[model samples]
Target: MLQNTLEVSVVKNLDFIESGVHICVVANQVVPNLAPILDRNLKAKRVVLVHTADFLQKAKDLASAYSNYQVKTEFFKIQSAFDIVSLRKDMQRLFNFYAEQKPLINITGGTKIISLTMFEKAKEYELPVYYVNTDDSLSWLVPDVESVYHLEDRVKIKPFLTANGFEVVVNELPSSNKLLRQVLDDLIANIDGYKEAISQLNYYAYTASSSLKSVSLSENVEGLRKLVGLFAETGLMKIENNKLIFKDEDARFFANGGWLEEYLFHQIKQLGSKIPKIQDNLCAVEVCKKTNSVKNEIDNMLLCNNNLYLIECKTKRFSKDQSPEGGVSSAIYKLDTLMRELGGTFARGMIVSIFELSKADYARAKQYNIKIVSLSELKDIKRHLTSWLS
Candidate 1:
């Protein structure tokens, strides 16, 4: 009986012939999956990417990440992509030449027909066939009951981004920004009764017409006066004669840009610091992305375990009658774009808003793999952050 299960450590120790290689028939859209396979020890002398001419640049980009290993590309015609017969012939030809060296085949990507044809050939040649699971882990596809092997590491986010054509700026959290942290901790500590009040206060901060002018607390909120007092007590802003005043730049910064972002950033940093076995977890605030053609910014980017957690902060209220063009939807769109560009499908997105998301918006967020942490979840953000990374 053949041993169908192989541990990652065992697989890495396998000896490869001088000309042996790992062949992957990949498409432009599925190029992200290639990273995991390459990250794991495949016991191959080199990597041969089978892709179309349109994805040649992407293939080369993928190749650049593995400088220690030889990586190269071979083009196939797009018109013949779904033609299984053509793919089979190509596989047969490849097998005829590489059979002596015993190359491994990964049927993890490409069109359905392409994958099917590759599967057939892998079986016919009695070759090793593998697939990368959704979580960027590896497993065998041919065996009825296969052993699941998790690679010890994943490609880091910065390299992954650079390889995928994103020019990223590494922005570090300022060491001198402890005042905002103190204020944020105070706000969360004293937020029991003042949830709505804090939200309403944030509204005022966000909408204040001028930095010099004190913004009047709305009279309609049930405990509007107490909320203003709490803001003053927390040292977030000054209050006199029932108007909320920004005493200095820090007060104005938290009020307008959002205390919610500061709070979440604080929690995220704390979680990353205390967590165990995290390869690399770093926070970058206002990290800018510029390629040859476009420019965009991320509010907070958490890079951990070679995956990206993109967080966008919002302090505004979302409408019950949610439209695709509404604030909630726009945030999701922005996060999704950043994910695709920066981390491909491997990136996870999150929006932490002091406001609540409507049912429609929540469902839309779930569909796009964008997690939402709204007003209700603010109290237990640490748990949410832990579960999100887990």
Candidate 2:
């Protein structure tokens, strides 16, 4: 019988899985099943994935990723996962075919009925069955409980998303250079001085992009000369005839606020020094589902302990020149939509911008449970991140 008292804290090394045994799992949420299979100590074996109609493509994608790691995989399908009687018949047939192998069942990914039904079948067949706890520990059920085994495996963005039926089609990681750091830090420290200056730079840079030609700007413009010189020293753009000239689209992008994304990416990585699993910090990440025509590009994102944090960075989008006072609500709407579509349990959505949001938009963001970090918040980003990430 599965008991409520089946909790253990002592880390137990799980070496029970022997060579060449077929490991079975349901494909509802693939990460839980992968906890043990992807652990460093576990050797390659055939993973048999039992999935419903909803997860067919995801199962295929997961199978491919597993093959890359040299683990063999197979699939079983149940037309309706909630159809208990038909599912039991199907599961019985599946078990009989693998009867010789006596596969292990991972009761980690399905509805209560699905897990309960599988557990009943495992008990009947005297097969080993275990559940993955919230802390990534394994709890044995069938064949009786003994200990909870802590999983050494921690998953990154790609595998986690793939397991959840998504794939990263395009990923542009942040740059690891001091140039961006200087520009970002200076702007953060003197936001007041650089506020209008950045907006002016963005205007000309956007003009250059619109015309497909380099636009000239005089550094002699009052309140802009000092900030322009800082950017000039960074070689982000060139100067001619006492004016700044954007050389290409890349420089234009930087002036038009690409640096904000880069800055947030670095600050997120800095959290790694105090926390584990920070290598998945990414910028300009585009993801798509394997079975659909849907796709979204995240400005900056990171994965911490399986929870995805999606952030949208903006410069002139919310400014009065580009949008009306309540325009932030629309961007918040996009973030909220992405969060609901991509964010699983414990996931979060946030908007970090150079401009402060209007009170109405701020209330709307609060209503959607999206976090807001504006110009003032950027200065103390470390503190805010520690709270949010922790």
Candidate 3:
């Protein structure tokens, strides 16, 4: 189930035959699962969607957008998707009505109960049964058709997110350049206690509404003055009346908000470029749920050879005695959950840390299947990243 490119290839092979009705199972995961049926070119005369009451309208609206194909889409609701008995009866009745067009049932969406019931009816009526197995490409369940198809660059970020559950999406990432890498390297080299320094700098700016209003760096705080002194050398800070002032708006924003994220974005984009044939690459993507209640941000993400990589960048020091909700522990949880929701089991997770980690923290990251890139590796960033991603 939920095959992206494999489904498209199967539809392409079935193009020679007369137009037939495609009965697609609709569940909450309609975008990626249903996209292969609707977006691709098929000799589908009409698409009959078997969906639950809540998502019935969404399916209809999605189908209506396909005016170029001139195919009709109808929605038949199942009062309760959990009720297998009623679902079978609806499928039987639809089969009787569209028996002449020879509809093909694609059991890639919906719950297991829906699929099993339809599959049983498919057997009883001796209708064609096909499934797209993302694990092993598209497979024929009933017809026993043995063929493997190769597809590339089929899944895009926007449609996949739109169908999954996101309502608001913004991804406008810039291309990687050597200048970014140089700046990041300079930050690490020129600054002492770089991670803690940036953390304190960020914390100071974060407490203010805007960087135009300067935050004072206490000379008594042991490392705060040194950090401010280093940043001042790079023109990121200005010393005025014994107070540390951000030189420009960019400095204020990055120092307070997403400096680490922006740094890793450029660094990873540069590393990913060295690899050949990456399907997609993006950074600093922000998305929100349907009601715009919860918003999730991805520092960097890339698709390669059917695997989606989710990366998180952190500039804070990890505490050995901190609670589970503490820095490193929470980051591990965030990366793992994002990978599971966005790319399922096949997706990968990584954490690129500007700070060093203890042995226990490294093991914790490993337990969550999160690869780590520590500050020491920044000198040979490309090599370390290549080995990890490869």
How do the residues 1-390 of candidate 2 rate in per-residue lDDT, one tens digit apiece? Answer: 333333333334544444454455565455576656776655548788888887777678678667655677888887677888887887778767775676777878767777777777766666667787876577877545557766664567777677666788888656677876887798898875677777777776677775434455654456556666777767767556645567666667777778888888889888888977453788878899877968888898887765678999887747343243346766877887777656555567788877776676667677877888887888998887777776
| Distance from true location, Cα of 205 in model 1, Å | 8.9
Best by lDDT: 2
**Residues 226-315 of candidate 3: C-alpha lDDT, one tens digit per residue:** 665545545666657766677666667666635666666666666655775355667778877664577888877776655578888766
Backbone clashes in model 1, listed as residue pairs: none
Weakest 10 consecutive residues of candidate 3 by summed lDDT? 1-10
Q: Rate the local accuracy (lDDT) of all candidates.
A: 0.63, 0.71, 0.65
TM-score of candidate 1 against the unseen true structure: 0.68
TM-score of each: 0.68, 0.84, 0.72
Q: Which lDDT tens digits does candidate 1 get at residues 1-390? A: 323343333333334323346777655444334454455465544666777666677666666655424455444334367676677788777767665666677777777787887777666665666777666566766432235756555555555555665545644443336655675666666555556776666666655556634566556866545655555555657666666677665566566645665567667667766764244444444344433555666667766655777888766565554566666877788789878877766788988776666777788999889988876677788898888888
Comparing 1 with 3 on TM-score, the higher-scoring candidate is 3
Compared with the true structure, the alpha-carbon lDDT of candidate 3 equals 0.65
Better-scoring candidate (lDDT), 1 or 3: 3
For model 2 the local lDDT of residue 259 reads: 81
